[model samples]
Target: MSHGLSIGDLAARTGLAVSAIRFYETHDIIKPVRNAGGHRRYGRSDIRRLSFVMAAQKLGFSLSEIAPHLHRLPDHKAPTKADWTRISTKFRKDIDARIDALEELRDKLDGCIGCGCLSLKSCALYNPGDMKAAEGAGPRNLTAITT
Candidate 1:
């Protein structure tokens, strides 16, 4: 009934549930116009926006992190390949940091196990006597990683 795509059309095109599409709208990740009948009408650009969100989530990004980048792009304009490339480049540093943090955790866990600290009275990770409490709370070795 209009130039915009229907909610169902968008769901079918993106392989997303209608409710998920609505949810994205609520989060400002996808913007839809209301038709004369008050039904949600999305643009072709919305598909690309949602697809980017999907890819970003798969890469371990929270909606919060992806939202700012999406906000920078035009809502009604379809992003070019180069546009996506430029937006995605910023994530590399975050990905690298996560990888490094995970590696550090693995190494620390290995060290703890190799030292037979798992069931010992003097455990580094288990903190059997609150020994690492002096260094502060929660996963002493991985304290460098944050939200």
Candidate 2:
């Protein structure tokens, strides 16, 4: 019999629902071993892995984006502080860029809200009707902020 936490134990410790932990496993975010009776067994390290997954999700990183970095750490082993620092650096630049974009969008929103007409020459100061419409259909200023 393997001495490890049960799935319920892991869910309790991580404050994640059992179904959510199972979902994470489906994505390869966590791997639990099966005991002799065919019950899943999880080590303490899975706690940290689940926590990292939650934090990455909170930062607006998708599961696909988070998977590669999680692959670098050994399974069933706790990651060292250095390992976390190294992996998190990749996110810092991207998160910072997103923050900057959102801030710029917020600033531009004030001017755009003043007028609903992109047809206005004055409205063209931020988004010219012909230039924006030529590219695609949507508020050009907001698209520019995101893209």
Please provide, for model 1 over 91-115, each residue's C-alpha lDDT reduced to its tens digit, 9 standing for 90 to 100.
Answer: 8778788888878777766443222
Off by over 4 Å in 2: 113-124
In TM-score terms, candidate 1 sits at: 0.77
Q: What is the C-alpha lDDT of each candidate?
A: 0.77, 0.81
What's the distance in Å from true for residue 98, model 1?
1.2
> For each candidate, what TM-score against the reference?
0.77, 0.83
Which candidate comes out best when scored by TM-score? 2
For candidate 1, give the lDDT. Answer: 0.77
Which regions of candidate 1 fall more than 4 Å away from where they truly are? 113-130, 145-147
What C-alpha lDDT, on a 0 to 100 scale, does residue 73 get in candidate 2?
Answer: 85
